[model samples]
Structures are given as C-alpha cells and as structure tokens.
Target: MESDSHDALDRRLVHALQLAPRAAFSRLAAVLGVSDQTVARRYGRLRGAGAIRVLGLSDPERLGEVRWQLRVRCSPDSAGAVATALARREDTVWVSLNSGGTEIACSTRTPPDRSDHSLLLQHLPRTPSVLGVSAHCVLHTFFGGAQSLAVKSGALSAGQVAELAAAGPRVAEPDGPVPELDAADRRLLAVLAVDGRAPLAELAAACGKSESTVRRRLEELAASGVLYYDLDVDWRIFGLRTHTWLWLNVVPSELAAAGAALAGHPEVAYACATTGPSNLHAVVITRSVRELYAYLTTRVAALPGVQHLETAPTIRIVKGPGPLPLSSPRDI
Candidate 1:
C-alpha cells in the first residue's frame, strides 16, 4: 500500500513533466492540489532514487545516421564478455538476450558514414563464444514515449488510445487497401491521441453520447488488436538508475542455446530475437552502475555461444504520458 502511494505520486509528477519537462514544480503542485514545497521535496527524493532523468530526444536517422540491429548467438559461458564489449560501444542504444537466453539482440545508432559492419563482423566474432550473426536496419520508430499513450478523456478513453496506436499510419503501398474509420471514431481518436486514460464519462460527453455506448466502441476496438494499455512507468523514482543497451553476435547453430542462457538474468529488462548481423537485441535496466557491472561482467558472460558486447549509457530522457483530456482520472 505504501509502495502504491509513492508510485502514484511519482506517476503524477512524471505525467506533469511529460507535458513540459522544465515547468516549475510550484505549478505542478498547484495542478495536483499539493503544496509547492511538497512537489520540490518529492522531486528531490525521486532524483535521489535515480528515477528522475532530465534528457532530450534525438532523431539519429534525421542526421543521416547509420543504425542497425545485431542478433548474436553466443556461448552461454562467455556472454558476459559480449555485454562488456557492448557496454563499451558509444553508439549502442539497447540490447537483449531472447527467451531461453541463447540469442542476443542489440540496437546501434551512429554516423551514416561509419562502417559498423567492418568493425562488428571482424571484431565481434572473435569474442569467446564463437558464432555468426544477422542484421537489420530500422527505417523508423513510429511509436515511443508518450506518443504511444493515445488515451484522452472527453472525446477519448484508454480503449480508444489503444486503437489509434495500433491502427498505425496510412499504408503507402501501390496495391494495399486502406482500412476505413468512421468520422466519429476518427474524432474520438484525435482527442485520445493527445491523452489516453481519460474518464469514460468525459469521453462520452465529448462524443455527445452515453457512457455505455462509448465503452462498447472502445471494447470493440480493443478486441480487434488495434492497441493495448501499457502503463507509463517513471522507473527513476524507484531507485533504478542504470539502463544499458547491449549487442551480441553468435554462430547460427548456437542461436537458441545462447538466447536461453542469457535471458534468465534478473537485470535484463527487455530481450528479443531480431534479424540482424548479430542476431539479437536487448535492454537492461538496473539500479546503479555497480549492478550494471555485475550484469555485464559476470552474469551475461556466463551464457553459451556468447561473443562480442557493447553498451550505451542513458544520459537523459525527455517525454512520457500525461493526463487524459478529462480533468481527472476519476471522471470516467
């Protein structure tokens, strides 16, 4: 119960910051119906917890940057070395060891002119596990941060937010047909796109309809796989300060073996099997630098088929989800 209270307060603060990171704490306190000093003191505590991060967003591809995903099959025994190497890479964004921990995945961003293949292929394979790799170039990331939260009250709700997010942008293929959205639904989505988690009553009100009717529409949209409700977490306030992106490369036959071995580590936050030169990508979230070292140096290296490693440290963060179009979460 205590944890929930702290978590709720932190989420409120984070929601406020997502709207404007540099906004005054007094303003935020006023909006939350709290004292200015309370906001300041609470933020200070959150910062100490390592959950609060002041950062900005950058579009690497916009700068003519070269980015790629590496999937690696590593020797389960030496996967830590792979993570170590990844931790050293300046361009690394995130890394993961897939289910069963035999395959490793990573994302990298760098100057378009840089020849990463040469360095990765030649240098990475030499890591202890000894394996091959595959690679993928991400064209763009359509959803991330608060953009993924489409819920807004008044005209929209959590259900609709999920819909707009999953609905995706207009398909641009010569032969592909576009899906149709009714005018009312479209208007609702626009409102939710700005704020998901809105009150159901407010959303119905905005649509000039009954709450039950609006809810039915949301249920239909959700059942269709249009979107999902993923909570926005302000992990920093919880004392989890460390986040690292790692890359690994493993031999083809060793993929499954390596992936399974590394995935069991407690510090790994996200892991996946991706098509790439390395054949795997993952993200590790931890509480401090010491834990990061323990993960990269010992736990990961112990996996099978492990070879090559690199990491990117998070310097700052900028955006996140906010309140729905409604005045409060209870309005629904």
Candidate 2:
C-alpha cells in the first residue's frame, strides 16, 4: 500500500490513536467528524490488515531494567535463521535483518541484575553461524516508544490534536519515582503487550482481578509513565520505502543537542544515546534512496558535532512492536 491508496480518514484515525491509544471510539468519532461505528470499523480494518497495531509497552529504565541494541553479523546462509531465533525470544522487543541480510539488528531488554547472563553474553555466542556481535547499552532515549512518527503526518489540525491531548492520560514527570509492577501487574502487562486495546474484561481475566480493580491499576500505570502505548505500522503504506540506521559519533559536549535535533526530524523514527564508539543512534525512514541522500547531505550534515556517521540499511523486519507468537526455535 502507498500513501495515495489511503484516504484522509485513515491518516486522521492513525494520528488520533497515536495521541490517545485507548481513547473511546465515540471520542475519536467526534474529533474526526465521523460516526462511532465508522471510527471503530476503520480501526478494525487497518489492524486486521496488519498495517498497524497498538501495543502497551513498558519503559525498561523506569522499571529498573536495561535495554541493549545488538548488531549480530552472521554467515550469509544463516542470517535469516539466527534473526528468526532472536525474534522468538521473549526478551527481544524487535529484530530485523540489515545490511542486505548479513547482519541482524535487535533491541532487547534484561533485568539490571542479570546483565552478565543476558542472551547477548550467553546464547548468541554459542551460535556456530554467528561471526561477530556488538552490543550497545542504551543510555537514554531521546525519542521513541510512545513518540510516533504519525505525529508528523499533519493529518489532524492543531485544534483537534489539542482536544485529544486534553482527554488523554497524563504523563508523569520523568524524574518522578518509578512505580513497581507486582505479579498481577506483570500478568496484566503480558496480555497488553500483544494488544493495547484489549477489552477491560480480558485484562481482568488475565490478571485474575475484577474489572474495577484492573481498571484502577491500569490507570495508575499509565499515569506513572511505567506503561505507555505505541503503534507499529508498515512505513511503506505512508510512502516511506527506505529504512536506515544512523550510527553517529558526536563530541560528548554536543551529544544531547544532536540527539534532540535528530528526534525532531520527520525522517527519524527512533533516536537515542548509547554506550559505544558511536554514542548516538537513530533509525530513519525516507520515501526513496534519493530522498535519503538528500537527508544525509543536508539535515544530517548540519548536526551539532558529528564526527563520523555510518549508515546501515534494513533489508527486512523479522519482528515488530507487538509480541511474536510463542514457538520453538528452528534448527540452523
């Protein structure tokens, strides 16, 4: 699907969901000037087609966990198998084949106390086809997670955006105390990881709690910023065909400024600071190779203190924001 194939209503609905992932259908209908049934039906069609999905994800930093970006180089014949195996692991959030399918890029989370035993240190090293692995420990995220590229679509007017923002759940201050998720909370999150818009009754059942109790806990999690919603969409539908990763080395003094600047660019889908030779990392999506070149020569060249930059184009995405179905790893 391409941008011209979708109508204004589709874009508007997607933008609305980005602002308020769990907003009521009636509220969305009012803002979009459509019937409640229409809004719901549109959402259903988009989701059913696998063009988009809303997922409830947790902040690892807020939960006292660590996140890592792994670049695994594999033999030509084994890259796909290795990537598929990584995607099947519950610890991995997203995995993709990059650099013409010879390398795998994956984002994974691990408990802070178990860093030494993480999949990066233990499991990956044992794979016979693995040639090399580089792990970058994420230090800070400038943009991503709850921040969606849909925000740049310009589908919704400022007035409509403000109206929806006003009704959305309030985000707590970043420095505020982080809330702990108990067993019940973990169970609730497990179900939500697959479907953010899962019904309240379903959540209650998963957590083994009453609907009222589940509702209260859900509200608390969102308010505390421990849990937030994100959207996973096929960029091709929006006419974005080129997906590339930017590994940048910036002067330490200007790292924050450079990261913040990249985060504001429409082409940037994710940006963060990590502990590696390249301290800054970002994922950019453009409509074509020509547009990507323009972005690199213009916007990227103008960053504050970039010393070096390396671009890795993604070949295919093996996993996305939503959890993958449980399955055994295939033999390589």
Candidate 2, superposed: residue stretches over 4 Å from native? 1-4, 325-332
RMSD of each: 14.6, 2.8
* TM-scores of the models, in the order given: 0.45, 0.95
Give the number of colliding residue pairs in candidate 2: 0
lDDT of 1: 0.52
CA shift of 57, model 1, Å: 3.7
Which ten residues in a row are the worst by lDDT in model 2? 323-332
**Candidate 2's residue-wise lDDT over 1-332, tens digit each?**
45666788998998898898889999999999999999999998888767788889887878888889999999999999999988988889668888988999999988877758459887898899999999999999998988878888788999999999887767756787777778999999988898898899999999899999998888888888899888988766667788898899999999999999999999999999999999999999999899999999999999999999999998788888768744322111
Clashing pairs in 2: none
User: Considering every candidate listed, which one attains the maximal lDDT?
Assistant: 2
TM-score, predicted candidate 2 vs. hidden true structure: 0.95
Question: 273-321 in candidate 1: lDDT tens per residue?
Answer: 5555656555666778898888877877776676776575543221222
